[model samples]
Target: MSYTLDRGDLADLARGAALLGTGGGGDPYIGRLLVDQALRHGPGTITVLDPDDLRDDDFVIPTAQMGAPTVMVEKIPRGDEAVAALRALEDHLGRRADATMPIECGGINSMIPLLVAARTGLPVVDADGMGRAFPELQMETFSVYGVPGSPLAVGGENGETVIIDTGADNRRMEWLARGIAVRLGGVAHIAEYAMSGADVRRTAVPRTLGLGLRIGRALRAARENHRDPVEALADTMAGTLYDKVRVLFRGKVVDVERRTEAGFARGHATIAAFDGPRTLELTFQNEHLVARAGGEVRCVVPDLICVLEADTGEPITTEGLRYGQRAVVVGISTPDLMRSPEALGVFGPRAFGLDMEFQPVEDLVPL
Candidate 1:
């Protein structure tokens, strides 16, 4: 299955990407605007191709903006950074890319690749490495499946380009990329996880772009029809990889502790019931990793823990959380591949330095 992404789909795409972002991936609002402007003068539409439709030898590269999420909102891209990065990588590889793919299907990263594809007239793979957003580049199915993460290409807005060609692993790639991003004004367009179509079909999370679009459409329809947006999201996600969705907490932000450390937005948020003492604490490194209430774990990383505006049903990223705002916390299960023992070793709670056993959201907190 395939769909053409045009300007009309920008809002829904951003909305859905934000929901899947799980409180990270940077803001999609700017990304939508950038893509909208590009479409106005560039290609009329971007074709999203299914992973299964690719030839075994087709070349695919995943693209994303790497840096602190907080920094991205302040320093918007030049609208050509992703394409520039892709071009640089293609040059370094001595071959033109066949298509672009999202490293993850969340927030601005999901749309960045679409912009690249639109400008280059390349189809985008319908799949991604992570079904949801992750803080580190290594926390992807590509690494779990033993795919190389370099040679990565990082590009800046002002004609700056850096090519990393090394035998280092994915973790080292992330470290080197982070330092380069900080040097390049805290955000850089990155092209990595280059793989053949056969590898993508074997390791990437399939159909996530379509899933995000469906989720965005569901929320919009729910709001228009005066239905419960949360329920609408749950129904829309039913039977998909993220099948279960539930409201874990209904409260207001009472306190927040966040700081940008080592090129990541590391923080924690405290939410308390409007009329009760029940409180929930969430910790994160770009994305929320753990959700606990009264010293009990309600949700953990790899499983999504999203915070949304209670009234608008719009997701609020970690950087956007503020004191005294009414919010609803929602949890969804991760895709099966992300929950596998090997996959979990990279993104599970223990991976984040938390001493807790990994548990599915469904088992930890019932809907």
Candidate 2:
């Protein structure tokens, strides 16, 4: 089934995307506003194409904002960066893009592609490279599946653009893009992981946008009815894309340590239990990478570590964490694709420099 995304969906999409962000992917608020404003002035509807309907040879490209999420809040986009990057890559590819997809299905990255689709009249693919957001470009499923990361296009708010052709080394592409983004005022729009429709069907996390929409809708309904939004979220997520969804900790934030380092928001947050000495510690590099309680690892990367407001259940990005904030920490299992050995190698606890081995959230905390 296909449906057009209009302004009505923005709030739910933003809220749901933020939850999927798992404490990173930047704030979706600005992206939602950008999309809302764009729709009012330009296209009234952005078409969403189902991944199963794509033809084998159709050319698909992923678009996203790159660099520090904190930087993006201060340096708002000029509303042309995504399209600029998309067009630049199309020119380099020597063919018209058949569709667009999100590099990740969280926060601003998820909405940017929809905004581009509205402007370019290209259908936005339903799938995304990461089921959740990752701090680095090389961590995408496309990169893990041996997809070429370049010829890549980077566009700046000030009309500066750069195209890179790095063959198949996505790590090199990420390195180059990060340097370029820092020079371009800490944020830039990027297009990468250009692939045929078949490759996308085989590698991309499927139906994530639709999943986000459902999650968002449920959250909204829960809040409107004065229900426990966190429990609503857990019930909504269980046995779906995430095999396990449970509140890992409920407390008040005791400490938050965050800084923009190497063009990424890097930090840790401590949440003290409401009535005990126990505390939950989250280490992050943009997204929460590890969660520990009482000196034991409760959750690790490849699985999701999400921080939410204890009452309203609003997701709190790493950049948004603050001392004394009442919070609930939730752990979610990654999709099957992300639990593979290759996927774990790239996003697991070890990949984040934590000494422990990777364990599924379900294994660590049985549902």
Candidate 3:
């Protein structure tokens, strides 16, 4: 029913979260740091509750950081914001929150629940809304299961907060949340999708926490044994390692174009990756949505378009893309879990406003 937390578990959780993040969710580093720091402080204990364990009267909600993961690096959270989000949401709902659930656990979302659990003395559900990370709050399984995204509360670093309640429709809830996040400087703390335990069981991705713990373990083992972390990761995720594509001209970042629109971190990461006359260009919205080599479309989303350390094969999250960084473009499949029409309808190319159809990652990468 409950278990003690440790570094090993965190590692696995991060890894699993990354896979579940699909091709997005920012980076998992911040989540790792937050959880590690929280555990180090030893406020109390973190417990994982089962979905069926919750009572009809039990109050449950999902908590996560909402904003551009890129801005989070420059604008660090003020530490108490997560708890503040929970408190604000509870105050608005007029109900005591009995447990916290991860909205999605690809990156910081994974750790926010743990932080909330430790700080608020609530147990965390071992599940998440999306089996992997999605670009919008409305895109979660909760939406699929008919849960509303409001009366939600968002907390900021300076003790500022906002509560949103929409009469109907989750998409509007996402829009409001995004607008606030932009005003908050590309990052905001949020508590959303308040639901009953039975609802959570029906909507949340089951055993994701345990799955995250496993991913962390696989990465740790790969690092300790000097194995290729990517391969180790592939095996763990049961994902196919797509064949390499031509180097989309590897160089330093020259320009980055971004704008906060419709509650999504929409942007492009441009780099000069050629030594001579050959250069490349990449375009993305939430994740690396598309790539171009010599003006040719080389990679696309609905598949995993990832930037990794050339030497280490570590993934670079959407927010982590920066200038003057030399990284390799790696493409992997989205795993069958996310390849369904329901999943694609939300995160597929059309959802991001791209004119192109959703192509499997394998179709674009060269053999």
Worst 10 residues of 3 by lDDT: 239-248
- Report the lDDT tens digits of candidate 2 across residue range 289-317: 99999988898887888888877778888
Q: lDDT tens digits, residues 1-367, model 3? A: 5565665467667665664454367567677777778777865458888777788767898889887765776777777787898889888778888899899857778888887877677889887876656677787777766788888898988899899888557889888888888888878889999999888877776767776776667766777788866666666655322223233335666667776564466777776664666555666666567777777666665565656555554556666667777766655665454556776676677777777777665566544
lDDT of 2: 0.89
Largest lDDT belongs to which candidate? Answer: 1
Q: Pairs clashing in candidate 2? A: none
TM-scores of all predicted structures: 0.98, 0.98, 0.80
Total residue pair clashes for candidate 1? 0
Cα lDDT, model 1, residue 86 = 88
Task: Point out where model 1 deviates above 4 Å.
Answer: none
The Cα local distance difference test for each model comes to 0.90, 0.89, 0.71
User: C-alpha displacement of 143 in model 2, angstroms?
Assistant: 1.2
